[model samples]
Target: MEKPLAYRMRPRNLEEVVGQQHLVGPGKIINRMVAAKMLSSMILYGPPGTGKTSIASAIAGSTKYAFRMLNAATDTKKDLQIVAEEAKMSGTVILLLDEVHRLDKTKQDFLLPHLESGRIIMIGATTENPYITINPAIRSRTQIFEVKPLTEADILTAVDHALADKERGLGDYPVHMEENARLHLSRATNGDLRSALNGLELAVRSTPPEEDGTIHLTLEVIEECIQRKALTHDKDGDAHYDVISAFQKSIRGSDVDGALHYLGRLVEAGDLAIICRRLMVIGYEDIGLANPAAAARTVNAVLAAERLGLPEARIPLADCVVDLCLSPKSNSAYMALDAAIADIRAKGSGDVPDHLRDSHYKGAKDLGRGLEYQYPHNFDNAWVDQQYLPDKFKDAQYYQPKATGKYEVALGQQKNRIEQWRKESRQKPR
Candidate 1:
């Protein structure tokens, strides 16, 4: 039986690997390390079908090290112990642990001692963030190389190579791919080589063989094998980025319908709970003050999604999306902080103004910290005019409230109070 196109075309050497040139190209850090025989334990962090496993295979095959494979989702401590023992006997063992984040804390801890002592050089591949999923001890010891999605050019090149390799590819079959059909497959695959090849193979298989033993991939055949039309956001690939971009922009633009459309795409695609949490951050950072309820609603949506775990949770996500989009827009708070950061970066760190510094510490008063700092509560309205900013930034205004939502009304009242206080302070007898 012939192997599947994805497996048959698996890269055997670094030169054959597709995408992730930053890590695997000639003279790159990872390539240089492998060349010098100085590969350390490391984590390959990226989305699926970005050649993480293929890279590991290339390293194992081309290098002289003893290679061992294990899946963290299934492997136990006993399996690790056996590998460690083998490595101790042998000079070096490269343990490739796929889905390393799936290992529980205990299993992760089991490998730490061996890793520290250099009994095995570990290479872990994960789609999740290592900082949140893996053991800190193990992570601290390993170098993390981020793998990026393949470019359009990279995907096209892979397809061309697959079509040209008569030994292990569709080259023997006289299959002609239309330009539009090829572009559609590339875009739908979303930078995943495996997915692209699989889709192409399926399309070709669905077509009837010609008299010359050749199959032509027409638009009709490709569309028929596609099953479901590819969504704008695929949850696993570049579509995910495109959908999220549309969702955020819709909310920012106050287009409630557009926002809900993107929300539907995301929920249908089955993104993890963490992605919802990240969207909640956008609500807080982008729609704050002008729509104070937006942040709270977004947070509740994330929590609901986590609790219900899809299908049911999508309802709350939909509601939150609409609410955030309809809410008045404001990024004043975000702008204020960004401007403040820019100033800080340009001016460098400055000492806290004397009036704002803590005076409770020993010798703080003697050093003039907190000197002449008026107590706001001591005043009639619990407000006082005091120098809170550094001398250079005394007049800098960072918090400009916008005229929108309930916050705007409350802020207007507060502004009036502040003005009254300033007027009273000036009129008082010296």
Candidate 2:
């Protein structure tokens, strides 16, 4: 049987490849590597259908190197051995390891020697972050490059090429696809060019040609084949950042309903990691010092979500989102740091006060370092007034606790007490 439209439509050469201008455009890194046939072992990472496998194929095609493909999720150790043997005999082999994140130790052990020997030029492809998923030993051996999702224009270009390629595509059929249908295929796939082409193929091949020999592909036919509509925010696309921004702002604004709504959208898209990270950011940047308990709870929930994974993950995630939204918010710490940083940039870092310098080392007392440092533990209520900042910043205060949350309210009261202590100490003798 003929290969699927996606497989047949794979870019056979560099010029045919679409998207990832950062890597394969003229004078780009990958282009230079391919032109010189100096391809090294590397890991290609990113969302699916952005052309990891296609690029691997193109490299070998251009270099005329012995090429082999293996799916790490299914292929056995023996499969790797076969490729390794071929590579040893051929002097070099381009081994495309798909789902490389799933590569087991047994297979990795077999491939490592070949990689070190420079016999197997491995190209690892993964949808997940390789640094987090791949074993460090294997990762260190391969350079990692991310293949970003194809844009709408890139997908449209690929579709147009497929519709015109007679030998391998749908050129034999006289078809006219509607603008909406074309747009749907391009955008709905969420940058998966292979998916767009496959959907386009199914819509074209299934629809009967009209009496005039034009197989007009309407939006209805395209929708029927594709089944799912494009989401407003893609998990790995530009809209993903927007959704995260909105989710964080909603929590910061104490808008529980808005926060939950955006949280649900992200959960449905199956990106627990992104949600977990956003929760942590919200805890510190948005909820800092206002509710220490909330920040702690958010951290615990993130741990639980990661341990449980998926369906159960959403439970902890929901708890976190709700807590974060309902809790009193503050950007005091965030602003405090920014204020301190601005000072540091405007004025040079002043020298540490002599009293604050280390006095534990031998002969340090000769220089009078830490000579008059006041031990706070010896004072009343374990609080004492002393110059902790550098000489020029003796009166500088970077932290200003907000009274928005109960925790910060207590902190504000403590701040008042400390100021009173400082006043009393100034009038007293050393």
Candidate 3:
């Protein structure tokens, strides 16, 4: 059987690689490595279809080295031994190890000797953050580079290249793709060249040619062929965390549109667990004392979402996200608690004040515990000056209230009155 269009259109050399100018462009690391023919074991990591495999193939082609492909997760030690034997005969062989993050100890031990001997130039490809997922031994042995998502223009360039190449692409066919349809094909795949090229082939093969003997590709045709836009969210990959970070930051920054965009992505990925967890955090961490009611409502919204489930769950999530984006923001309460925690961690918490300590036990008065304790409720405004903090931290102030909302403003005013009373009490004669 003939190879698929995507496989057939793999870059023959570094020059044929479309995107990743940062790595493959002139004077860049990979380009310099190729130019010098000084191949080294390396790892390329990023989202799917962003040209990790293409880079490996291009490197092998440019160097004229024998290229071999195997999956770290599936291919056995025997397959690695075969590649090692090829390296022994050919002087050097480039091995493309897919899913290198899943490499087990046995296969790793077999490959390490070849990698160290410079007989096998290993190019590991993964959709994971290699630093986090790959074993430290393997990671230490290779150079790590991140392949970024291709731009729309980059996707269009590759698509055009595929369409114009007769031997490997669709240049043999009398196919006429409209400009909008071409743009849609590039955009719809969301930077996946494999999807775009294969989708193009599917559209061409499935559609009937006009009486004039030309396949006319339209927007609808390409849209139907591609089916759905590829979302760059692998729960086990870096993109998942990146989206969650953006979602929380957008809401905290009060950008309704930006927050909604990220929320929509999470919704599309069906990550209700993360959504609920993050929203509840943002409600307290970002909205806090400024709008406690909004934060409470956010919790209720999350509960509703959990009960309703996705598709329909997105409705309440959207409502909460919008409310959070527009609500008055304050982190004063948590910040105050964090400050006290830092002090306790650094200087250590001193003993509780004797006056504040429990004194209901036998012979407690002899220990002076609660001996001078005064009940604030017996005084005016249900308030009185008393030592509440440990004597060592008597002057420490952790609660710095913000005036972002009416409720916090009232609390701030009350705090000022208490501070004034404490100052007066401290100055008075004992």
TM-score for each model: 0.68, 0.64, 0.63
lDDT of each: 0.78, 0.86, 0.89
> lDDT per residue, candidate 1, 261-352, as tens digits?
87777665455443585578778777788777778878888888778887788888777777887888777788889888888888876767
Predict model 2's lDDT versus the native: 0.86
Best-performing candidate as measured by TM-score: 1
The superposed Cα distance between candidate 1 and the true structure at residue 217, in angstroms, equals 3.8
Worst 10 residues of 3 by lDDT: 228-237
Best by lDDT: 3
Q: Write the per-residue lDDT of candidate 2 for residues 31-100, one digit (tens) a residue.
A: 9998887788999999888999999988888888888999999999989988877876778999999999
lDDT of 1 at 138: 77
Span of ten consecutive residues with least summed lDDT in model 1: 227-236
lDDT (10s digit) by residue, model 3, range 286-310: 9999899999999999999999997
User: Compared to the true structure, candidate 2 yields what TM-score?
Assistant: 0.64
| Model 2: residues with Cα > 4 Å off, grouped in runs | 104-106, 208-213, 216-220, 230-430
